[model samples]
Target: MNKKDSIKACGRTINYEIVYSKKRNKASIVISPDLKVEFRAPHGISSETIRKMVSEKAEWIQKKLEWFEVNRLPDHKKQYCEGEIYLYLGREYPLKIIAFDDVKEPIVSVKDSELNFVVPKKDSEDTLPLLIKKAVWNFYSKRAEEEVEKVLKVYSKKLGIAPPTFKVKHQKRRWGSCSADNVLRINFQLVMAPPEQLEYVVVHELCHVIEKNHSARFWKLVKQMMPDYEEYRKSLKKEGWKYML
Candidate 1:
């Protein structure tokens, strides 16, 4: 079951959703990327108990909400049209939409400091945005494939370990993760970030193969690989949302 509720925190009433699940053994609270708060609790948990738990976690929840507020992507209702700026490798480039009569599918390319979108003339203005979004995704996915592979190869060789298979996809809450089988999954949105930031994420996840947790030893390995990793990591938190299309 799902229900909407609100809790008082920091002299304000913060709205949230409650989900009751049989699979859950305890209560868990999460602040979504969009700043929506959610609480999942096991069956038979009382509302008062849940409210008390939320009160206990009120400070932490407020901190997360503030972080999201500061880091959220500006212009969430951005229309994919000409003159709109997009990020590539930490640089902003204006988008140029070019309608072509003979083009069968949307094609996106970067040339001379501009992102060009070649779309069929038959597509309506409403449909053009969707097509442009698809084109942009394709462009990022291709770059992710090339750039992530190169970084992984270099780091794997330096670390003297077999490189794990990696793939890029959309992720809501994580930059990258290492699976139990040692496979690496990178967020393709990161392709828009600077190369150094991308490399930092790669090395951080690669260190997970040696140490599964973010303990001192795991961070030690990460520092050994990239001495400036902490700076890059903080930058990811501060300005990473600019890359989200």
Candidate 2:
């Protein structure tokens, strides 16, 4: 049988699918030229033990992924122009931009496999592009507010803690964070990832309500809420370049 699992390695989450064989004696990690990670192992090994072993070797795995990243251009890079492919909920959607001065806010919606974007105004030649890009981003942040809140509510109950005040916003390098004052801040770009990936971030932040740091207890609490969360985290990291505007 094949199983999906994740390990925190080199301060990054590495998700891999594992194949079990009764005859195999040693577990090995295989990295495809395209950077997909797979593990082959003997049967009857506990997941925690496997995770520990993988974590020990995570530095190597992380370096391999980085090597591939450095050697190749990012996959699905976006230009924020018409005909560009965009992602939402892990699905691809082509971008379609329209400008209107009548509206006060940028409007973005998905319909018929298109990311329909409406800008607040049609500006002068040079400024229009920047305006549209900013507007499109704002649309993402707004939608994140709606979508992320629903997930936070669901996981909040599962964790048996009152959902704290949270906001969807931009972070230059971080995905999500929980403040010392008990507020949760999620990345707006996360809405473009798959639902499970988004759920993982929400659960990760919500768990902070109980465990303030990424200590052993914090990870244990996270694992309790989502056993496959590391897989999602790894996935998000892998395809993250394609998901942003």
Best by lDDT: 1
Candidate 1 C-alpha lDDT tens digits along 50-132: 88888899999999999989987456555888999888888888999998899999999889899999999999998888889
The C-alpha lDDT values of all candidates are: 0.88, 0.81
For candidate 2, write residues 1-245 as lDDT tens digits.
88899977677889988878664678888875467788889998888888888888899999999988778655543567777877788888888877787977667788988998777664555765676687778878888898888987888888777789998887744688888788999989988898898889989989988888678998999999999988998997787665556
Candidate 1 is scored at a TM of: 0.80
Judge candidate 1 against the unseen true structure and give its global Cα lDDT, from 0 to 1: 0.88
Cα distance off (Å), candidate 1, residue 47: 9.1
Off by over 4 Å in 2: 1-70, 74-77, 99-106, 119-125
Give the Å shift of residue 117 in candidate 2. 2.3
TM-score of each: 0.80, 0.66
Model 2 steric clash pairs: none
